[model samples]
Target chain A: MALKVIDTIYIEEEIKEHPRTIDISSKFKDARVLTIGKFGELFNKKSQSFRLQKRNPALILAKKAGRCVLPAPKGFGIGGHKNYYFSHMYNCLYDCSYCFLQGLYASADYVVFVNYEDFLEEIIEKSEENPSSVKTFFSGYDCDSLAFDKITGFAQYFLPRLRKIENCEFELRTKSINIEVLKSMEPIKNCIIAFSLSPDEVAKTLDKKAPNIKRRLDAMKNLTDQGWNVGLRFDPLIYSEDWDIMYSKLFDKCFEIIDNNMIHSVSFGPLRFPKAMYKKIKIDSPREKLFIGPFEMNNGTVAYKNDLEKQMSDFCQDQLSRKIGKEKIFHCVSDVV
Target chain B: MEYSYSIRFVVALEAEAEPIIEDYGLKRIHEINLFKVYRNNLANYWLIVSGIGSINAATASIFLYQYSNANKSSFWFNIGIAGYFTGPAGEIFLVDKILDEVTCQTHFPRSALTKKIKRDELLTVSKPREPLSTSHLIDMEGFSFFDVVNRFAVRELITVLKVVSDFPSYGYTKITKNIARNLISNILPDLREFVAEAEEISHKELIRLRNPASYNEVISKTEFTQTQSKILEKLVRDWEEVFPERYLIKEIDGLKKSSEILRKLSSDLNNFRIDWL
Candidate 1:
């Protein structure tokens, strides 16, 4: 309860119009109250008037309206193909060095748009719009889906909606130790709770503010016990001095709590970034070692040397295929133009 | 006048808060040094669980207060399981007062605006200990729990409720490893409803601060003189001269913009607000 908070304050107006505003706050029991205003809702406009001022710590509030929902990005699917993604919240709580948010956002403040119904409504409408028999809507794309469970009540509100959507499958991606949102309700059959995993050493060194491997595994065990369709994402695999040994052990540790059959799918990709994003992140925090990794600009993207990427992907593919049948594994390619 | 209901809950990590996270449905939305964002719901009420400790509890509470959007009748209840001195296992108690044992300061939630519930004495300490500190319950997160809720001017909206599962008290091992799924499921719904009602009443009692009017009224204020305001305004203008958002945007806009790249990126950055930190 004694969080070393930098500051606290309040905001008023505009945020009231959000559909999911009902669930955006539950996490900070006692946070420093900062300024609360209604005018900061438009992301683009807010950016034009932005200034980086250091405050102890404050939660900013802004109300948003219209276009409350979006289709999942293309090429963002898993398993049987159809995929769409959406995020209710932007940015995240942790400040990991390699996080895209650092380069993506100009401010470190946390903003939770109090709107959930609109997201659900959009999902329901979009699913109806697609007319496809098999379709999936992905959450947690812009932020960890469950990381703010206590704040947004995402699962509490969305799970019931998904249960109603006969052809819609929902995926929640996260690296958090929090899973009570899922445990509170019956695990939805079409819903897949995907976990992002990294080796212990990598997590310890680069993951920064995330929960350690043991805690994450413990959460996985509980989720599986609850009969949730679990997924493993070993994405943007970091190459360190002892990657092979570290990955082997990580795989073994993973198999301990997760049955390969219960897992919906396993996917991975190499560390790749849009070249401009890499440059922006470097400018934001030049000391980040990740920018200096054996990388090259291929097309507009920065990625590991082709040979290294091939070696890593090939090795992971082989090891994962041996453990889980080939059909259950997918390699997210970075060279997609 | 009635306001919307907001149930606020605070949980302490005797060992670590991770084990109980699943039970709370908290996903680490984001992580900061002292706190991480977690959101969940039990029935109609939304519950926000913070990181381990009092500062986090306070910070999370303030965040919830601003974020709640609760009207006059909104209720704020701090719902979570806690330790007790002599309470029966599975017994629930509504804390009448949260005493910060470290500071020897006391925070009492206004009982008038809340529905009368089973009341008890609860002492929050900096650290969790055995044999119960001779105070009723022992916890680490409650003091900040009282502090933050009090700031929103909704003290009555705030209530501390706990399910006693341990004694002497709930050993850290048992509390951390065991309390999940089953335990939380049983207690949360009823608590959620109770919090909703309480926050609504508390909201009615909150005194809204009046907005200041014209320059004449502003000048009538005692603390600052017209000269001071001018000086402060001049200082801010001087500072803006050195660092202007427009200038920065222009200088870096072309080199960084390139097909609206910086603009999009800056939008994301500028859209970043610290309201819900």
Candidate 2:
């Protein structure tokens, strides 16, 4: 439903004269321009509606002030103590039904911070805190790593600069199949290109506006063939009739073209939502079948009933065990702090 | 359950609606209350010329929606002339923000369709008052149009396109029926594209919701209350989406009576895991 039409751009007055802002404004010559004091005034305001704004979202370009890199959430990283995450942009191009982003923010518009260098500088500072040892930082937690690469050029600009800081590892977590920028350049050993996946049925029905599963797996095969470290993320495992065999075939298809040795890590997460977020999403989309299900409130979070949750988690775990070793498999749950 | 209509244009003035009606080749199909309703079913476009003020705009929109039995897929747009604090007499704007002077309430209109036009906030006032804000535009019926239409549909499908008629530089006397009609005519080509895009979205949305007569029969047999009926409608549609091949009678071998039907249907669908997915 949406094209690259950010006709009305709200640029922070401070960043109006910045090089990145100038470069972006040059791209949308026909877009109406407006100035604001800071992005928070527009982004964090309470009166905005996310569902309505998503239809025709405007672009908000601003400078990143204060801290750029913060520690990642406890259960967010994979086997790393000094895990950190930075959002050069907030919000993703793809619209997944189970994405936490929908409930996390009041607006759906993409907030592209024009200050990438500052985020890198802070990452460099954080990495130096424990120099000579390896630390991990993840991008695309707040936004997709490469979905908007054609427009944002995120990996194209960051991958080369990240190579300079050799001590730290970076993970570009995304569901996007756009690997042209990554294919153009040599693969970095420390950077693991993770692809988020779901079964074909789920991806086709639930992952609206996202690349097809076949195309995504094909892209992963291409990337892995180029000797890049590829990670598979089956996060937020959606439950439907015959989901076990669906995910089984999905995994079988993945391992068909993707080499097992080249696989860096594979993780799966259960479908869940916060209590308030569930309410908000329910109210916003009353016809959403996914939300209107037999969900139980567990510790202020709304999720599938305990038995169904166990069945889904255990089934996925059992399927992965048959094809891959346990060392590389991780299940992300909130209690792992 | 049967609506497949397109853009519903709500204008406060007859002159502002005339050029649009002429350009779109709209025919005076019927009348709702005292408001003249123009329709172009081939293009799936509808127009209602609300007389004046927020009450009229709100009343006209409510009337049009009720008269046609429209659904959420139908888009409602308020196209009219407004006075701006600055800018030329013919400048056009998409009302991204609207404020009601009396209620002190604000509404923001969002659109996904791309067009080559500028956007700004507008204020709805009681009288022809001077503009207090430098960047915002002043109007008589924008906030009510936005407020009422949003109640009928999602905010994204509701739009407001205003023409600059009486700016500070241009005197109020310069405003005329001919000028208002001309200003709306100037933007018809772009508005046509915008309306077409909205229609495409409505078509897609309606496809997901369009159910077969048999499903409706089963839903009605459940004898759900008014509130329950709406909820059941969503549930049935969602079930159809995921398990398109599953049939009620074929799956459940021996189901009789309404209560048993509801129990068996919900039990089997809910308890069973969709492994194919």
Candidate 3:
């Protein structure tokens, strides 16, 4: 899906004159520009409904003050020993029904941290601190890495700088088909363009305002065909009556065009959320039918029943084992679980 | 059970409220002396004429909310006149940013209606001021009206609309009660259109809050704890969403205890297979 036109923008007082902010502000000339002391003054305010704000979200441009990079949550990475994630942006352009951002954030406005240099500086420092091991730096945990690239210029600014970090591997996870910036640049060996995918039926029903599975698959093929290593993420495997057939067809379609050798890693996991977050999401989208599935609370986490989860996981694992090696496949469990 | 959609308009003057009350055919309720309240019982439209200042607007809004029995889904609108730095006088604007001159705090009201109406920034001062050279639209109650109503409802459900009554060129002295009435009267069609769009949005929320027909049937037949009642309400809602063609009451007719009814409903929903196609 293409990015929609933004109608409003809130700029932080400190970053009002920042070059990146000015560059972004230039793109949306017709949008109403409002100044504020901090992004949180509006973004974190109470009584702001994420559901309502999602309809017409504003963009907040601010500066990331400190700790631009942090360690990734447990059970959240591919295979790197040291996995860290950085968020230069908060909130995604797409509004998937199962997205945790709806619950994690009070408002649905997009917050772009214009301080790209601070994040790069911290990433380089962390990578240098762990020179002996391959530290995987994951982007798009809190937001899509490339979905808002045209507005934020995140990939254009960060990719070349990250390419120089030899000891670190950077993963840009996204469901977006916006890859023109990546296509223009020379392929970096350490950068893996990971595309999150689900069955066509599941995605059509649950992934609102996102690119369809076909478009994502085509983007993946286009990227990998250009010698860029790609990662396949079937995480949050949705469960339905025909889930087996649906996922099998999805896997077959993915492997048909792209060779298994071009894949850097493949990860899949059951749909799950922390108990508190699950409740929040349920409250946020009370009429959503997806929450009516066979889920149970275990160890303070809400997910498919243990037996059902095991059955689905094993079936996918067995299916994936036929195409990819076991070493390259990872099972992502919820950190709370 | 049926859920009615509601919208409350908080105008600062009786003259400002006159056109809206007449347009919606609202009758004045005699009980409330704190503020002048008017309502259309059949349409669920309400209006309160708050006197003047920031405190009066906030207090009158709360009073109307309680007196009218407004719910979380109800839309609250602070609509009235304001003075803009440069205005031809009948131009109306939906407020996007509200700056309180006393506290210097800013508030942003979230509304999809901005796309339908022209928007501007509003400065809520402690008292009326001479038109400044700045671009802010001046008002006396916008900030407090927004701050207080926001606590009771989501930002999207709360809005502040201002019509230019006076400007630097046409000062405040020329504006009389008749002019105020005429300004609002001339813009009644646009105001009605805005309220209609707001009501359309509020109707969707009301549907979300509406209970299934079987909910009242089941609750009337059995006694349940407050916690169990909430659970049953959710189950009933899920049942209606998933199996709208089927009657939940028919499935739980013989169940006496709330626990039994809850278990039965859960088991049926869990066992039901959903076809994505």
List fnat per candidate, in order. 0.00, 0.40, 0.72
List each candidate's DockQ score.
0.01, 0.26, 0.72
Q: TM-score for model 2?
A: 0.75
Instruction: Considering the two chains of model 2, state its CAPRI-style docking category.
Output: acceptable
The per-model lDDT (C-alpha) reads 0.59, 0.78, 0.88
- Model 1 spans with C-alpha error above 4 angstroms: A1-12, A17-57, A61-66, A334-337, B1-277
lDDT of 3 by residue, B92-160 (tens): 898999999999988988875644667889999997777777888899999999999998888899888
- Provide the RMSD of all predictions against the true structure, rounded to 1 decimal: 21.4, 5.6, 1.5
lDDT of 2 by residue, B1-277 (tens): 3545567899988899998898878888653458888887574677888988989999999988887567767877889988888767778888877789999876656665566577888999987776564888888999998777777777777889888888777755678899988888888887888888777877765654466334666765545666656545555555655566777546434654555655665665566454333
| Stretches of candidate 3 exceeding 4 Å from the true structure | B1-3
**In candidate 1, how many Å is residue B50 off?**
45
Record all residue pairs in model 3 with backbone atoms less than 3 Å apart, i.e. clashing.
none
**Using DockQ as the measure, what is the rank order of every candidate, best first?**
3, 2, 1
After TM-score superposition, the amount by which residue A127's alpha carbon in candidate 2 deviates from its true location, in angstroms, is: 3.9
Residue by residue across B1-277, what tens digits does model 1's lDDT show? Answer: 2223334445544223343455446555454334444454432233455656787788776665556444433445555566777645666677655678889866544333233345666777776565365647666777678776555533434567766766764464576435633455566565546645655444333322111112223223334445655433322222223233533333333442132432333343323221100
Better of 2 and 3 by lDDT: 3
| Better candidate by TM-score, 1 or 3 | 3
Candidate 2 chain B least-lDDT 10 residues: B268-277
lDDT of 3 by residue, A29-121 (tens): 888898988887889678878878888889999999879999988888899989999999999989888888887888999999999999999
